[model samples]
Target: MKVSSMDESGKYDKANERLAQVKEEVGKVMVGQEDVIEQVLISILCDGNILLESNPGMGKTKMISTISKVLGLEFSRIQNTPDLMPSDITGTHIVDESADTTDFVFQKGPIFANMILADEINRATPKTQSALLEAMQEKQVTVGNNSYSLDDPFFLMATQNPIEQEGTYPLPEAQRDRFMMKVELDYPSLEEENKIVDRFTSELDFEPELENVISRSSLIRLQEFTRKVPIANDLREKAVNIASATREKEELDYGASPRASMNIVLASKARALIEGRNHVSEKDIKEVAKPVLRHRIGLSFQAEKQGMNEDKIIDQIIEQQ
Candidate 1:
């Protein structure tokens, strides 16, 4: 889909302006992982949740922290542990002695921040894992008997360690579907690594000031624009076909849910806006297919025993479709 440079509505120009500012801010601290950054932006712009899988020391936390700083938002980090409780994440109520009565006042946890970094999410127990579902889906946190809406432009960037499978309670299917994308961060190039080491070991821990270019109102406008991005009938049908193939294919056990199709289309639209286009394209759909659908689809026992990863299965589905 080739969009004209001059959009009649002029909305494309606004999206591009904000995108440029975000990219410029992200560039200050992050060395590589451009695709990862783009995917994260897609989720944020679409008001969707993200689940990031990466080996330790890949700077997943740093990337999210940079995003928060650039946006001039409050950032919070939570380290998920096996013994962590739901209250630890969602916060519990406390009694006020001055009031002389017990009122369920929500204290709010790390999840209440504008930008939250959930480090080692899978390490937390399933009970604790369920605590995030409401916040991620409804943009609100419920503690005790009261609910509190999170800040505007709320984003959850959760990281999970893939190397450690033991003693980890994998996120259930229902909870996993709430995430918009599951991005995998890989090792940086030798040159990038060299730069990182030199910059970090030196006394000059370079921290760049990310200018606040987009305001709360502008972000809401961009999200509305994302919804208005055109998705042709044929492209929408193609997205469904690709999702269905994952379930019907001989190599796979289960297929992606209806939510997968919804996320793909929405994410594709966001990607188009990020690229300065007003309409979604097949290329955008294909680019985000794996991350959006990988966790949503279940694998067969044989496929799992054979060590077939979700990425490989997603590739086959996209190719066949």
Candidate 2:
């Protein structure tokens, strides 16, 4: 495809405008935590999954559900639990009594949707959690003896509550690494909270209605455009350097893999497009570095004894680099 300057600019402008509409629509339902919204948008644009960590009653589910509405994607929610079986999520074969001959028919599960919200994902056992591995990475679900392909532009949004750890299984490192970004949603600001209160308790009934800002096909095209956004050669190395530096730090037991670097650049490009820019910048890389790498690296026991966290370790790496 020969993309001319004008053609590229027009497509980018349309996408930029559409994204602003999406933000506006989501904001009607959600109050504060704009960063969380932005990071989720970037991850979606990059065709990756997001791991959202927060306390209860943060509207994590409400926010993502609203996002799916505006994107015009089929959305499904999975409330993970200890007893939730892999078959429950991926579907299974059922007896086909209607058929002339006795046979079993494969039934599609919630994993077949365009966007899936895995609520309280940590509540599921590792065995059950692993069910999402193939679907998330390869956009395919295997059930019975058959492999089923998921919809195009498949995206997963998973949430976990950090305050409650009991009866919760930690996400395996392999699954953690599959998420492109780990978004943290904090409490609403005072003014934002007041607005939230007013909206819910208004004398006039108020319901947030989100229209589809862009069609599903348009979103896929935007994703292609996001990938085509130019990145400077130097910025690429800096992105890799940020991830590689974590490995050299003796205080950290394990560092991020090369996948971290790839996500950083991909996220940076998405951020640039959101900001109405045609090319990626070093600043874009730095802005997305924290979320892209925070969950990928492991802290040493010594560092844990010293009360060091992943964000702090990531901060040090970015500062020195």
The TM-scores, one per candidate, come to 0.93, 0.96
Clashing pairs in 1: none
lDDT of 2 by residue, 23-98 (tens): 9999988888788999999999999999999988888998899899999999999999889999989999999989
User: What TM-score does candidate 1 get on C-alpha atoms?
Assistant: 0.93
Q: How do the residues 96-149 of candidate 1 rate in per-residue lDDT, one tens digit apiece?
A: 666768665657777888888989999998889999999988999887667889
Which ten-residue region of model 2 has the weakest summed lDDT? 200-209
Model 2 C-alpha lDDT versus the unseen true structure: 0.91
Number of clashes recorded per candidate: 0, 0
**Cα lDDT of all candidates, in order?**
0.85, 0.91
Model 1: residues with Cα > 4 Å off, grouped in runs:
1-9, 99-104, 163-166
Off by over 4 Å in 2: 1-4, 203-206
